[model samples]
Each structure stands twice: as C-alpha cells, then as structure tokens.
Target: MKKYFLLVLLLAGSHVMVAQTKKNGVYTPDNGNGTFTNPLMWGDWPDPDIIRVDDYFYFVSTSMHYVPGSPVARSKDLVNWEMLSYAVPRYDEDPRYDMKGGNAYLKGSWANTIRYNNGTFYVGFCTPNTSRTEPGHFSICTAKDPKGPWKRTIFKEYMYDPGLFFDDDGKVYVAHGQERLFITELNADALSVKTPQKEVYNNPAFPYLEGSHMYKVNGKYYMMGSTGGTTGRQICLRSDNIYGPYEAKEVINDDHTYPGNGLHQGGMVQLKNGSWWFIIMQDRGPIGRVPNLEPVTWVDGWPMLGDKGKGVETFKKPDVGKTHPNVVPATSDEFNTAKLGLQWQWNHNPDDQKWSLTERKGYMRLKAGKAAKLSEARNTLTQRVQGPFSAGTVEIDVTGLKDGNVAGFGVFQFPYAFVAVQQKSGQKSIIMVNADSTVTTIPFKGNKLWIKASVTHIGYTASFDYSTDGKNFQKIGNMLNMALGLDWTANRFALFNYSTTADGVSGYADFNWFKLKDSL
Candidate 1:
C-alpha cells in the first residue's frame, strides 16, 4: 500500500514539472519557470537552421518568394528571438525576383545553411528553377556580422538543400541532394565547386531525404536531414570521415500522435554549457510552418531528441546562465522611424519610387503605380499572421490618394480577401474583395479609416472590419478561408495601394501605424 501511494505521488510531481509553455493565444517556449514549450517561434519560420556564435545564437530560415530573403534571427537565449538580417537581400540575379517579366512566387531560396567559419558568417542556399527551361542557381552570402551588409555570390549549379561545411583540414565542402546525399569540395573562397561530387550516403529506408546540415562534433561528421515530406521525420547520420560510410537513425518524430504535425527540416545547435537543442519546424496549417525547440542528449555518440526519440511539447529550458523574456518575431509597426520595422516585407523587390517614409514624416507613403491587379501591385507591405486568435489593425490616411486608386488592408495569399477604400473621379467608397469572388461596395465620406483583420481558430477563418472613428468597427467583408494556398505559404497581413490605370500614373496612401493584438 505504501509503495502504490509513493508511485502515485511521484507521477503527479513529474506531470507538474513537465507542463507545456504557452502565451498570447499561441505556443511560446519560454515558461517563465525555467522551462519552455515546444514551438520556440509561433509563426511561420520554416526550415530553421541555428548556430551559436560566442554568446549569441543566430538562426536562419527559408523565405520562399519574400523580399529581403533568407531571414536571420539572433537570440541570447534560444527561446527569445529577434529579426536580425537577410542573407539574400536583393535577389538581383533573376529579373522575376523584382516581379518584372514573371513572378517568382513559391520559388526562391529553400533550406538555407548558416555556418560561422573563422571570423565570417556564411549562409548558403539554392534557388530552384521556377520553370523547366530556366535552370536553378546556388548562392553563398558571407558577412562579418549576422545583421549584415552581406555579399552574395551566385553559382551556376543547383544544389538542393545545400549544407556548407568547413572541415578541420581547412577544406570547404557542400552536402546536397535527396534520396542519396552527395559531397563536393569547394574552392578556398567557396565561390564555386572545384571537385567532382560523390555520393556519400543512400538512405534506403528514408527515401526523400533532404534539408541536410553538416556538423563536426567530437571529430565525428554528422549529417542531419528531414524526410517523409510534410508529414515527416528528422534523421541524423554520423560518420568518422567527412566523406563517409555513414550510419543513420531517425532522431525524432511527432511521437506518432500529433495528427498532421511533422517534426522535420530544422538545424541543431549546442549551447555554451555543452547542452544540445534541436529547433525543427512543423506544418501548422494556414499559419504555415512553425518552429519547435527539442532537447537533445548525446547518448553513445548519437544525439537523441525528445523522450526516447519522440518530439516533446514542453521541456526544461537550456541552462544559458539566465532566463529570457518570452519574445516572438516582430509584428506591430508604428511608422515612427525613417527606416521601416523589421516586421515589414515587400511582396517582391519593391519599386523604390513607389514607397517612402521620408516623404511624409512618420508615415509609410505607398504610391500606387499603374498596376491593374492586386497581384501586380509593387509596394504592398506585409507581415506574418500569428495563429489561434490574432488581429491586425492599420490606420490609413486617404487624403493624398489619386482617382482610380485603391488603398486597403488585406490578407495576402492565394485566394485572398481585403477591405479597401477606392477613389474614382474624386468620389470615394469602401469596397470588399472577398474570397468567394463576391464584391461588396459602400459609399464612404471619410478621409482616414482604421481597418482591422482578425484570424480565429486554427488560422483558417479571417474577417475584416473597418472604422472611421477607430473605436466602432463594423464588419465589411465575408469571412476568408485562410488556408495554405497552392503556393504552400502562410497568409500575411498586407497593406497596399495601387492604381487601376496602365497609363504610367501614380496614386498614394499614407499609413500611420500597424498594430497587432494576440488574444491570450
């Protein structure tokens, strides 16, 4: 009887120590009790690659078709992250990157690798061919600082899921491809491949193996990659040689319980205290792919994640000397500075003449150039939409808008929806372009209006409302089914202004602020 009572007490205590950490209507890793949760980042930051440099932890992720691409984030504690820089800032190699001749939607850098060698930080990624005729390109960007004035070098060959590794012998090599991983030597400058590529490992068990990141730990070369696609699993391969007779194992999965949640496509890092953690991404529906930090333990020369090779939802925080305040990626923008907030990203390469912060002090003035379709609008600014229950509010001043101009706030994705104020022949009215091909228009007499978009549930349903008085907002459009589009990306909170004419005319709108609120 006493043994049974003691066992019950011990189980209850273990449950208390292993509670999940969450915050603000979303999953937050930092628990404030020296423990954190599964998803270190709540929003869509897919295919994360993390590296520790001195006291700072630098993170890189895939930015497929967004400008200022290959996002780099810095963190003191791995749980709290801030936007740092973009490895590929301009995407200048392709004209489609600027949305000129064609659109590079759903095609940009994928599964970038971030490495710190000697004194420089290197980010390498491959841009896949959007079409069969156009070939893909691989590029490496290097910088002294993670937040950088990075210099990009585009190579001719395409290396899918490229992993940059600097061996102890001072040799640079890249591990790339799927089904069979290949290793090729690079020149000292890492500008281009020098040697013929060799097939190192062929995973017969895991067929679609990619997202490979090379790491040398304790004189052993480790190649970590994800397989099984969207409903995937993370695997780790270890070898004594850089080019190896490698042995592989699946390190972590969803524990085979979380429906549709795949634990795959992320990088691992060792903390200053010699503790290891893996930050991998999971497909979380319309909110897109989010990141989760799993505790890793090295057992018998292998890194093990979660409980007995299963991903954990909560765990003890890394012993990084101190705790960090819970932080997610930046969202709200006040438009108070000459430079735009790190949260805002242009849909494509922006037209320099079409957008300005200095023209109207303390406002983002987006000049609507002659673009008849919303997809062609050049200066549309956007930020990711947080999951569960989150709202985006923007204040727009329409006093400077030209005739045949439409200025509004929207959910930017395939099959998107928006509520906007359109001005034609000096007459202004509110119009809604809803998801279901329905258009609702109402006469408007106001010069300034506050627009709000609220996403509810599992990031699928969204509704738009507008207010002339900023306090009383009325619903303006039908609810948007905010699913992950055919493009396979998250819906974004978009603010845009564009002209309907193709006569080289321009109209503009001034945005005072963009505020975000996440329900607790």
Candidate 2:
C-alpha cells in the first residue's frame, strides 16, 4: 500500500515537471504572466522591419548568404512569433550564391522591408555586387499571400537598405542610401524606377544614418532609421513632404539592457488599441543581434521610444485585445516529415539532389559533398543558436561513412569548430576541429554516435562533447571562443557531411534527430 502511494506521488511530480518545461522554453521572451522582457527574441534576428495588416503583425529580417533569404514571421500580439516563409527562396543573382568558384558570404540580403498594400504583400531588399560581370540589383517580390508564391522583379539599380512606401496619391517611392539619405519615386507597379535618385536629407549630426523605414502619420511624413552601426541609436525624422526638409531627433539611445550595445535599427507599429510600439535590435555579442520590444510614446508630435528614451527591462504586454499563449520558434526536429522544418536553412544554396528525407524514412540523409573545408561544403544545414544559453544534440549513423568523409555537427561562423566522425584509411575516429584549425582525434569503431554543443552567453563560449551510448557524453575539445568575425552574422548551429577526396560523393550520413534544451 505504501509503494502504491509512492507511485502516485512520482507520477504527479513527473506531470508537474513536464508542465514547467513547456511554460519556460530555452529562452522565452514571455514571462508567463501579464509582463514580458526586453528582447522579444534571444537569437540573431537583426535588421528587423515590421508591419501591421489588420489584426496580424508581420516581420522580416536579413538572412545574408543563407538560402531562403529574408525570413518572414507573423505574430498576433507582437510578442509570440512564428516563422511564416522566406522572401527569397533561392538566389539566382550570381553563381557565387551556389559556392561555384566563389561564395557570397555577406552579400545576399540586407535590411529587408515588408509592406502590405491593396491585398498584396511586397518584400524589398538589395544585394551587393559580387563581381564586375554580375552586378548587384534591388529586388522586389510581390505575393497575394504573405506565405507566398512570390514573384520577384530585379532592378538594375542597387538601392542600399531600401524602404518601400506607398503614398495616398497612388504613387510609390523608395527611401534608400547611407549617411546621405535619398528618395526615388517608383512606377505604379513599384518594380521600376520612375525618377533618378535625389538626395533628401544629409546631416553630419546623423553619422552612418541607414536602415530607412518611411511612414506617414497624422498628415506628416516620418522617416525612421539608425545611426552609428551596431553600437548606434535610433533616429526619427519628421517633415511635411515625402521628399523632406526634415527635422531629426534621437529617439532611442539606451544600453542598460545590454551594456555597450545600444538598441537600434528596427521598425515600429501601432496597435489597434492606439498604442505605439518600437521593435528594435540590440547587438548582443557573439550570439548575434537580438530583437527588443519598446513602448513608444508620442510627445510634441514625435514618437519617443521606451520609457523617456531609455530601454525597459520588463513591461506589461502589448494590449492586443487579448492574451496569447507563450510560444517560440521551433528548435527540435524529428526528421519524420517530407520537408525540412522552417527553422532550418542552408549555409548557402544547397545541392538539392544530395540531401534527402525520403531516401531513408524517419531520418535526414546528407550525402557527402566534395569540399576541402566546412565553409566550401555544399548542403550544410544551419539554424540560429538560441541564447542566453542553449545546447544542441544530434544522433547520427556513421556506418555509411567512407574514407575521407567527415560528418557531424558544430557551431558555424567565420571561425567554426565541430566534433565529427572521420573515416580515413579504413579507420574510423572521433575528431574535434577547433576554430584555430587544430584537431584532436580519438579512435572510435562505433557506427552510431551522439554529439552535443553547449553555448553560454555569459562567456560567449561553446564546448563540444560526444557519446557512443547517448546517455553518457564526454568532452571532446577545449572551449571555443565564439567570435563575431567577418560574416556580420551570429554564429549558427550547422550540420554537415563533407569529404576531402574526389570520390567521396558516394558516402552519406544519416541524422536520426536533433534535440535542443536550455541546459547541457
């Protein structure tokens, strides 16, 4: 009878633990009450542009060099968001996007703008010129639905950091450029330029002014942008005309939330309840720039961000007429579906024929691609590394690995490190490749293994471990110092299978599943 009573208590305790786990994710912005935290998301969601279409809010962010570029997300309360679609499904602008002879690392998309007009959705972004023969062009993708079948139009002119706006007069204009702002009128279709670019506002006071978001409020034209790059402040310009004789003010310049990294470079939206809110980005070191939600107060006909121009650490949720369940972007993947989860993207353009989910049911089969290093390897699947702390674990079957093939998981950036299983000269071994190009190896005859990477924002460090039995993991490498290098992107978790030899394409790696947790 005592044992029966103890079993009941154990079952009750297990249920409570499961409930708690769901309530608090690895890094949820929702505090689970009436209030929430500053960063709406604790991951690399930089250069955010938001818009409101009736009751729903839509957002788009930069996805440079990653296939399915410019991720778009949707939210009801502007706090909990879900991945909707990618603005650019693939890059056909240049051969470099496919890593053919060269690679487009930091040149694909930047500061994308999303707008809804007359039952149509438009997404605009610019790609920098990769070569003399392949010039960069401004792209406008239009869709009847935000989730898309988007049709794209590429313009000859490259408009840096474009802000697409539709005026009441049934005309279109694009506000673009850096330091010196320019305005260019577009044709009614908004796919071609109607006029040559003309400088509108150029002030030395606003150094490095970019990321333009144009809007009209209360019969006044407002141009919102950021200055001083990553450690910058948000600025707003007001004028009576779209082509402005404008007056500027520094709206937000706070670093209390993330000291030395100010909140800047994002758009704002007005809720149905008549409350204004600013969704901005904060440079949070190696984990990448994170998005923050700040309240906007109008003073003297000017929009002031946060509490009197300061960032708020905690505040009441936006009154979207109702409360919303705490939700976040999906992280764990079972690989049981025919299509890859929206959370995953390729490092660059993937060779579709090399990777398959149908070839091996209940698993993702990544055929080996010939590459000397991970950066040049095709079909390297990647996803954002969640912060302030998170761990990613994966189970892989290495039985099909051939000589010169290396398949495993690691965090990817300019400087990347991973714990992979390498088969060389008929010998299979576990190896740790550090950011500095040093390697550590140990013999392992196991056909299946589990690898894990744990990241902590406190020290901005990542450590790797591997296990043959999945339950017991042993450390493999020294702590990797996650650095913000040339990529202009936050470090991402990458899954890759590449080979050093020419005949390695015949080998493959099968990934069973990927799991993520708040702790190691």
Candidate 3:
C-alpha cells in the first residue's frame, strides 16, 4: 500500500509537470539538454545589466513607472532567474509617484547600471520627467546585499542611462549621455560627480548612440552602448585610458536570426570559467523587450555576441559550475505570504492603506477608494503579460466587496481590456470592458469568481473567460487585439479593486491566487 501511494504521488507530480509545460504556461529557458534557448527570461526584461558576484549572477532591468522599480534578479546559471530585490523601493521624492494629478507613465526609472564593488552592490538609474518644469533626476542605490535595504542618492541634474564604474585606482566615474558620451569623475562616496564632464565618445557610424555602460576589462577601458535606436545593434568603444580617443565597433547585430530582430541594450559578464556571455534584449512587439542570452566570444579584445556576431535561438548554457532547475521570473502568486510576491508591481506608487495580504490570511485584499474610471484606479497590482502565448487566471472572492466597487482582472494599459465583477446595491455582475469603454455585462450571482485573460500569438488577441467551478469556463466579450503601441512599456495582467462612488466609501476584493502559464 505504501509503494502504491508513492507511485500515485509520482504520477500526480508528473501530471503537474506536464500541465506546467502547456503552451502559454510557466516558461523556462533551460532545455535540460546541456543547452538553453534564447530569451534568458520570458517577460519584458528590458535593458538588462548582468554582473557576476562570487558564484551568483545578479541582473537588473528597467521598470518605468512601476514602483519598486529596477528589479534585481539572481541566478546560479544565467538561464534560470528569480527576483532578489528592487533597488528603488518607492518614488518618495515626487508626488507624481502616487499618480497625483499626473502620471509617471513612461517616465519613471530608465535603464539601470548595476555593479558590485568590493562588498557593496550599486545600481544607478535616471528618472525622466512626465511633465515640463522637471527635466529629470539621476539617482544611485547602494546595498550590502543585492536583496536590499538600499541607500539612495538623488542628483538634481539629469543624466541619461547613468553608468557607474569603480576604477581599480579607487576612483568612481559615471558615463552618460544621448548624442555624446560624457565621463564624469565621482567623489569618494560615489554620490556626486565633479564638474567639467569630459566628452569621451560620440556618434560617427551609428546615429543616436546611448545606453552607455563603462567597464575596465583586461586593463582596457571599454564603453559599451546601443546605437541606431532602442532596437538597434550593440557597439563597443575601447580605449587604453579612462577618458580617451576611443575606437568603436558594432560588435553584435541582427544580420542572422530567425526573427531578424535587432539585439541590443544589454551588458556582458564573464563567468568563473573565463567564458563570456552577453545578455541582451530584442523588441518582440506586444510582448515588449525580451532578453536573449547570447554566448560571447572575445576575439582580439573585442567581444562578439552569438554565433559569428548574430543572435541565436539556442546556445550552450553558461558554465556556472553547477546546474540549476529551470526557472523563469516569478509569477502565479498564491497570496499566502506576509508580503506580496516580488513579481507583483503597482502601476504607480500605491496607497499603503489600500492593499494587504494579512487581511484575509491566504488572500490579497485590495481595498478600493473612489475612482471614476479604470484609468484613475490606484493600487492596481500588476505583473508583466508574458508572450508567444500566455494565460493569467485569478480566483477572486467578492464576498467582502461593497456596492460601487469593481474588482477583478485587467489587461491594463491605455488601450486595455478588463473582465471584472461590479457590485451595485446588492447585485453583482461580471463585466468585460474594452479600451474604448465598451462593456459586456454578465449577471454573476456567486461571490466566488474565477476569471482569466488568455492571449494568443496568432492574431495577437486577448480573450476573456470566466469559470464558476474552476473547471468549465464560458467565453465572454469580444477578443481584444492586444496593443503593440502604448505609452507604457508593456501590457500587464493587473488585479485591481477601486470604488466608483464617493472617496470615503470603501470596498475590497480578496484575490486567492494568480496562475500564469506561458507557451512557445
């Protein structure tokens, strides 16, 4: 009987493994065959900067407008990654962070440069303005642990893509700019830069050269930046001195690839075994900028990405001493922890009193304040909508909800779609809303609701589905053609609760879990 029970457990685990591998389920890059595929991460991990600290690899990426911005992820092997921490926990400096009268939108934190010097980890990023009068703000975060209680230093002047480098001689320098690259020497604390910023490199071949990350590799100062555009090619400027007459070369391009996509805007890291790898991103339409791990071959001090200077769909895994289980960025929160999952980000700076995980013990309670429209909704917890194909399903209990409260799942953006349950007086109805404010209402009598938003790569459409029993699901609303063009970076699956009535009135929705699946 014990043997039979063990066999049954194994079968159940096998079933779960099969289910997770379903199309648009949890996407893992590791192929389990000593090799891995492109997209080291599945979601919109744009402007990736990777650094090796001891045996672990740390990665940081841009999170425009998403509070708890510039997420730091860790990995044993480059293929598998998990969220370690966020460098900028909150945008406390500006009122717009909380979406005051204005929204940050596409103008929060931009590309981050993460580095580990001695014992502390440093992350530098620039926050651009959403409105005039405010040009931008440059900031740096330092932490003993990458998973941090980070100390931040905000600079009044704007520096685009501020790359921080700690020189071997103990001096710190920053390389930043758009049209022309400037190298400024930082003080001993690395909190501020000295005047008379030296112009190091400028665009001669690739126009609009920016996203500079400075490094001193093998006794040579190498300034790496992307050019042409955001979706351009990777270029490297090398010089023997810190500031110099730098020679440039286009190291990586999309000349040979399945998608023929421009691979750019990422950093390089050499593994313990001395083998180098370049982690870069390519814009994949509505899916946003997804990362591709390309093997780097340094030929005569020049690093070439992928095979003979091009992106490849599959490549040999980084030789990081040991193998790790196939893992993607965190998603599918069960809402059982004291804090929300690291995968979840608020659309903007969230109201602290508005959301909690302890309110319902095993659920996330999103309390709604007054909001006239979905665009005005605050405290909307969101996760990046994965691509190729993916489905995000949530089990929300509407029992605690009051009248004038609308709570459920959303494909959140300017041109977005949402399938939510609305409460009025005593009646509870499920409604699907399109970007143009078109609504499809369904009378839902039950307090327990299971809603799902499924997106397919075929038509690049997202469809809504609702289930009462968590088994049989009925399709509702028109299929939403996912917008590739939005002011924001990418569309996200958001679980929101907001009141449509007076500001004082409050109602809440308890989300039990969010399950996401991604397919090829």
Error of 3 at 404 (Å): 1.7
Clashing pairs in 3: 24-517, 24-518, 24-519, 25-517, 25-518
- Best candidate (score: TM-score): 2
Highest lDDT: give the candidate number.
Answer: 2
lDDT of 3: 0.80
Higher lDDT: candidate 1 or 3?
1
Off by over 4 Å in 2: 1-24, 130-135
Residue pairs whose backbone atoms clash in candidate 1: 29-37
Q: Model 1: per-residue lDDT, tens digit, 313-350? A: 55677789976767767777779888877787788888
Candidate with more favorable, higher lDDT: 2 or 3: 2
Candidate 2 lDDT over residue span 212-298, tens digit each: 999889999998899988889999999999887999999988874555677888888999989998899988788888998999999
Give TM per candidate: 0.93, 0.94, 0.92
Please report, as a residue range, the 10-residue window in candidate 2 with the lowest summed lDDT. 1-10
- The residue pairs that clash in candidate 2, if any, are none
TM-score pick, better of 1 and 2: 2
Per-residue lDDT tens digits for candidate 3, residues 1-520, read: 0110011111212331111122124666676767776666657888889899988999999998898899999999988888999998888887777878766677667989998888989999998875588778898999998888998999877888877888999999888888688988888778887664788877666787888888888999998889866458888999999888899988987833324457888888888898888888877656678888988888899888888766876567888878777666778888999987899899888998988889789999999878877777878889998865788999999987888898989787667888888988779998999884756987889989899998754555788899888999889888787775554287788899888888424788999999997522
